[model samples]
Target: MSEIAVVAISIAKPGCEEQLRVALEGIVAPSRAERGALQYDLHRDLREPRRFVFYERWESEDALAAHGQSAHIGAYRKQIADWIEHSEIRVLKKIM
Candidate 1:
């Protein structure tokens, strides 16, 4: 079985960094409480203030898929749609 992970990158719009941060922050607590979640962490790029990355791990690919379809994530995507310049998501597998 593969160990699943997600590396999501987001760039906030020129003046909407705070709003983007808040929206991301709002989901952490609930996401971490998810049954199949192993880890869910957020990081900001010191070199680029408007850039944020989410490092997440899950028990399996199915868990991650369920999370993508979850209500909170759906709402979050919609909420940040206008505030973000762009977003990139990569699903990964542990190699080591």
Candidate 2:
């Protein structure tokens, strides 16, 4: 099966960019170490510092699901619950 791609966008509350960035940064290494993690990347919008984006590729849908239930991810979510203003996640299937 082909890999699954995930695009997650997070927006920090006004004035909480640094706090959000720190929290988001904490997830990258651990997430990359997961069993089925293929690629994990975080990006900051040049025009909007408070906006953060995650691009991830996983071995399968099940793997992606496991990533969501990962202990580190759970912890990260709880840790940043109040630091973020909005978040969106999209799962994609490659076409080419």
Candidate 3:
């Protein structure tokens, strides 16, 4: 089966960029270590410093689901819930 990809975008609330960055950064290493993780990367928009994006690839839908249920992810979500102004997540499957 083809890999599953995820794109998550987050916009931080004013005055919360650094804290949001730290919380987002903290998830990378552990996510990369997950069994089905193919890629897990984070990016900050240069023109919009408070904007953050996550690019991730997982082995399967189940793997992606597991990631959503992960302890670290749960904690990260809870930690940033109040600090973010907006968030979006997309899950995709490659066509070619």
Candidate 4:
């Protein structure tokens, strides 16, 4: 199966940046250790401190799907639902 990549972005609500950051950071380690995870990195926007991004690579679509269904991810979504102002996620396939 071909590898897949994902880019996820989240913008925190005003006054919730630090709390959102801590919650997001808590998922990194466990996500990286999951099955079929090729890369899982978290980044913060320099100009917009409340914006955070997750750069991820997975073995396949199934792998990425599994990741989305993970316990941590569910907990994370519930935990940050109120703190996030906006969010986006994109799945990609390399062509070159």
lDDT of 2 by residue, 24-82 (tens): 89999999999899999999999988899999999999999999999999999999999
Off by over 4 Å in 3: none
Worst 10 residues of 4 by lDDT: 59-68
Instruction: Give the TM-score (vs. native) of candidate 4.
Output: 0.98
Q: lDDT score, residue 39, model 1?
A: 97
**Candidate that beats the other on lDDT, 1 or 2, i.e. the better one:** 2
Residue 42 Cα positional deviation in candidate 4, in Å, after optimal superposition: 0.4
Q: Report the poorest 10 consecutive residues by lDDT, candidate 3.
A: 1-10
lDDT of each: 0.93, 0.94, 0.95, 0.97
Q: Which stretches of candidate 1 lie over 4 Å from their true place?
A: none
lDDT of 3: 0.95
Better of 2 and 3 by lDDT: 3
> What is the Cα-based TM-score of model 1?
0.96
Clashes of each: 0, 0, 0, 0
TM-score per model over all chains: 0.96, 0.97, 0.96, 0.98
